[model samples]
Target: MRQDELWGEDTTQRYDTPGTGMFAPDVVEPAVHRLAELADGGRALEFAIGTGRIAVPLARHGVPVTGIELSQPMIAQLRSKTDEATIPVVVGDMATASAPGPFHLVYLVFNTISNLLTQPEQVECFRNAARHLIPGGRFVIELHVPDLRKLPPGQHAVVFTSGPGYLGVDTYDPLHQHLTSHHFHYTEDGQARLARSPHRYIWPAELDLMGQLAGFELESRHADWKGGEFTAESGSHVSVYRLGPVTAT
Candidate 1:
């Protein structure tokens, strides 16, 4: 795979297709709705706020936003939104950037934490968010819980009988605990365009331990804000943390 062809840069163009709102209205709306209430109506920061999907809407909800994003094309895609140009952005890696100002909330949505491939980077991301958070502020993350044990070898793609022609290619290496997924969207012309994303999957409990390592306390957690308990079968994990006072060196 060519380096440029993979999912490293310009995530906005990749994830922000026009009329994409209707693609997963049920899942996206609930997630956004939950985030809005937790925002605290104060200075809020979004790590990897791609194309302003949730950020734009949260801004519309009358909250100020500071975005830390790595890709310029992703930042450009945010401005491409209706009335989203005013949202301030800092173009840098969220794991190491001085995100500026003491924020009441710093959030990473859509499992964006996995974008950082290594465990060290993910830990630093937590520390960075803590560095920018105000006293008693919160750090929020909505991440996917990987079901690796369910996948078996010799499986590349399977067409579901329910027929949107769902094909799932599971690419995971047990040695590294990395998941590289290849999603193929079939066109009417019998061609397919692949959206291959590589992610480092981590369990929810393990991430909580990571937060502890970064001076954050697990404040609250839910399976979903629609009122569900987190279980092994849960598809997603929505977590919240309260940052401890800045540690002295």
Candidate 2:
């Protein structure tokens, strides 16, 4: 998949758009419901709000949410849903785009920031988020903790040929320090789309440093907000940051 096409037109979809294969089965319902609750209302902004998975429900719950997306098709698909037609959708790169207003909470969930490729850009994204929030506001990031050293040197591609042409492909460039994987499902239906989210993985320590460089103070890190301590070798991470020192009232 080309870099531009992968996240742009490929992802803007619905449940039938790909389902659990494209999205992890744990995406919605309790997990996403809990994620929405973290915002706690008051002009929330979600980065890379593809298809309104959490945004729609949060808005319905009266959160007054706004979304920033790079793909117009994704935004169109989001608005196509009756629930999100009226919600604001800003189309631009998340690293530089400004949201509609100062938000109490700015969340970039589903490991969206890893799409930026460079560490500097990721830090810049955090800074932009800081510039968009009120004092004491939050910038929340959710991602899976990556284990790269475990993999062999520059391991590029994991092919599981369980069935005919049903192979999984996970590639990495140790030299470039980036990893992205693609999974393909083939059937009589002809090369169907499964779950394919290719991200430039970063460890929790690296990401936390990026946030700090962007002028944020680490607030908390959880394995999951439902109450899980963030220890080494964890799978998922929910990192919260205080934007900046409060301006005196």
lDDT of 1 by residue, 69-157 (tens): 77776776677774444688887888997766888889997788987788998999999988998878889998888876565685533
The 0-to-1 C-alpha lDDT of every candidate, in the order given, reads 0.75, 0.73
Best by lDDT: 1
Q: Which candidate's TM-score is highest? A: 1
Over the stretch 152-212, how does candidate 2's per-residue lDDT look in tens digits? 7556665533567566766776666577666676778785767665567787888878877
Clashing pairs in 1: none
